[model samples]
Target: MVLADLGRKLTTALRSLGNSPVINEDVLKKCLMDVQRALLEADVNIKLVKQLTDGVKKQIDLDNIGTGLNKRRVIQTAVYKELCRICDPGVKPWKPTKGRSSVIMFVGLQGSGKTTSCIKLAYHYQKKGWKTAVVCADTFRAGAYDQVKQNCTKARIPFYGSLTEPDPAAIAYDGVEIFKKEKFDIIIVDTSGRHKQEDSLFEEMLQVNNAVEPDNIIFVMDASIGQACESQAKAFKDQVDVGSVIITKLDSHAKGGGALSAIAATQSPIVFIGTGEHIDELEPFETTKFIRKLLNMGDIEGLIDKVNQLKLEDNEDLKKNLQKGRFTLRDMYEQFQNILKMGPFNQIMGMIPGFNDFMNKGHEQESTKRLRKLMCIMDSMSEEELDSPEGHKLFKNNDDGSRRLRRVARGSGSSPKEVFELIDQYQKFAQMVKKMGGMGLFKNGDLSKNMNMQQMNQINGHMAKMMDPRVLQQMGGMDGLKKMMQQFNQSDGSGRPGRGGMGGLGALGGLNFK
Candidate 1:
């Protein structure tokens, strides 16, 4: 799970301890210890975790009744604030000059995912209605031109690069001129990733910076490098006015705790996070929401925003159907499609306060498969059979339920047991919705409140079984799953990874599961 997500779960568990007229010192201490343990287990820096815990404790101890804020709330808020401060380095937003194209230069060490990031950024701006072009200045790499060109082609963005041109600075200058002539709104220059000791390569980067005169210079760092990421960031900052930092490979990093700390030490605001290696695997760094999630607090604002973006209101018919506890197969199919738009199942689960921890336990893939199987079974039902309760009754009574089940099983290429399982699961879900007062419960936050420890544990256990790599292979393997995740991550200009179709399953074998 993401650090922010882990924090959210920890905070929620702490809040579960009732608020009182007076702060319970023992309970507070226990809560803090729990928080500390959770962070440590997530590979957060020990020192940093202590600093955070201590800060919260100090705030709690100094609390006054007159402030109107409960001691627990105060402590929770303080911890949230501190985490945000550390995660975000206070870097100014990239503001492009009006009526003029802005130039962005990408820099990083070798294998830090610089080239891919450049293309992704261009794609992001292009989606924002900007005419974007890419400049391949990394003549050092033999196939750099082809790589950038291919990415540009995939994104349908323009590219300017010449294999014959040996001078990096001259290429950048020409690229910029060509972009100007082409009337592109943004020009992104991709430079070769060079080490600090490579004086000649560094000099070339500086020359390109001067020649291109980019409005924004972003240093891409690998989060997997841990503490060393600090020095690399600092070295780059010293050379160029490093406007922001993009830490990549976060999805695979065990010690991602250093990610925030490194940005904190460098005094660079984290503008983006690269969660995976795909072109779209980036997310905007939201300080408040991230910190809140890390502390196990619900990001209500983020949730609201997502709801609005998805135009949930437009689906009034579906909402009404759900409110009546009359979920049909068609409704279920639409819900699956909507969830797909929201990104990966793991990511969506992370947005929930307590579920984030369960997700970090590495059970997301399993849960996703179950949901997909359920969706497929629903897909096999006819429109009339789905819409009418009587139709379902007849279908189930005639021993036709068996025949229909077999048909669904065959249609979905799944077992009849799987089809039966989906029907049973949806029946339970429908019952829960009815008990909770239907879809209104979601808006009123009643759904979250009703989610008890037992239910959460059950969900986690099921998720664990579903996400097992072996189970995924039975479905289609890592290549298929990774592509799905990439699509989920890259849904918006936020740069989350895209589900790159079904070809990414092979890469899963190399994943360090632990």
Candidate 2:
């Protein structure tokens, strides 16, 4: 079973507790059994699964009969914590400070995505203002140098590899030394991928390790290997000092239960997980957020961090316009751009509460298509029309302005009606933004502060009206909508790691109008 399916099964089992006439021992036992079955089916090691469920059972004491406490919530929370516990090795990985030179070594079996992961890690740090470089020392594999050269060229990160260098250690030492001399913040050394039976490759890894003396050694694990990942990870750990692990091929369909189990076997923390084939698809792994996202509870912290990474140039402009109660078509266009830049459409939707289930397989593709089409329609418009505060009126469906709408549709290869749909969505966003502005929500430039509960509900009510009725229904009506917004606001101000002012735009993106 894939991780998503396992999460669903666990969620369903927990939700069953609410349906029970009484939260008694038998009911709890049934839920535990369901949880155990789900984990086992996901290919989690049998021992780990048993320990997780037993730990959850031990935490819940129905016999204590604490008055006024919701047993269902307690039991569900226990299960959630236990799930997180099994996935977390509680070991903090080494981090390189800015302006300091550091070397990282990559080791993994062939086809484990080790090469791609090295590039992804370099790109990740590069984006964060670090001078990152990659060194390819995989002389065992043909074209290894070319692969690193090609990807690094595309990512604009400096890379060192030689087609003629027969000694991997020489290449590794030279690459690290040169980057260190240039004052690079992070230098990643990509080693030859090897299997347990390949003693020669292991010896080569040890040689490179001694030459570069990497600050951290990352072992990449392919999540598609099912329960065998534990053994494979153990094999790698036994051969070298693996300080951190990165699980690759953990996309939606991957069976990642074994990858999670491998954490225990390797005794190393997972620094990141590859979610897709794209270079930007790697995400830093946080146990609580991962489990929460898996259980369909959403990850506001992750969402905020993603938005912050955008560092949108005109965020101040957007915030000022919202404060002035003026939202233009250009504002909506920029937000659409932010959403697209935030990573995959489904991944963005999954970070918002109540959107995971709504953005399932087919629906995600359709929504992405629709979003892109809307952007295309906007692309065909003039700057005057896009930046105009008149919004939908700029393309009014009347004799005088009808030509403008038709022109946009024709230019975008879309129907006039489709153009109107885009306009309508923009109008809804405008209305929500205007209402929020009127409530002084943006006056202080903080979306999470200085708003009373009444004001929050008022804005939530307005937003609820503008959202797709089906989406609102799936979100559990007005109460659920209110709760979701409150959760977002609370998370925003939790002193967590996220760039401020991004929340203003982040909240706007969450108002998916279908």
- The number of the candidate with the highest TM-score is 2
lDDT of 1 by residue, 390-507 (tens): 3335346657788888887898899988777666544544454444343343332112333444553443343333354554553245444443333322333244432211111111
Q: What's the TM-score of each model vs. the native?
A: 0.71, 0.94
lDDT of 2 by residue, 1-514 (tens): 1266777887889989999989999999999999888887888899999899889878988989599999999998999999889888888888998768999999998989999999999999998789999999999988888999999999999999998879999999999999999999999999999998889888888999999998999999988888999988999899889999998877765367888899999889989988877889888888887888888888776776676667653578877887877888888877777777878766776776666667776776777787788889989999988998866887775874688889998999999888888887778778777777776777445564667888877777777766778878877898877876666666543455323353445444444756
Candidate 2 deviant stretches above 4 angstroms: 311-314, 493-511
Q: Backbone clashes in each candidate structure, one number apiece?
A: 32, 0
Looking at candidate 1, the ten consecutive residues that score lowest on lDDT are: 501-510
- What is the clash count of model 2? 0
Best by lDDT: 2
lDDT of 2: 0.82
**Which regions of candidate 1 deviate over 4 angstroms?**
4-76, 97-99, 126-130, 314-327, 378-391, 425-514
Lowest summed lDDT across 10 adjacent residues in model 2 is found at 497-506
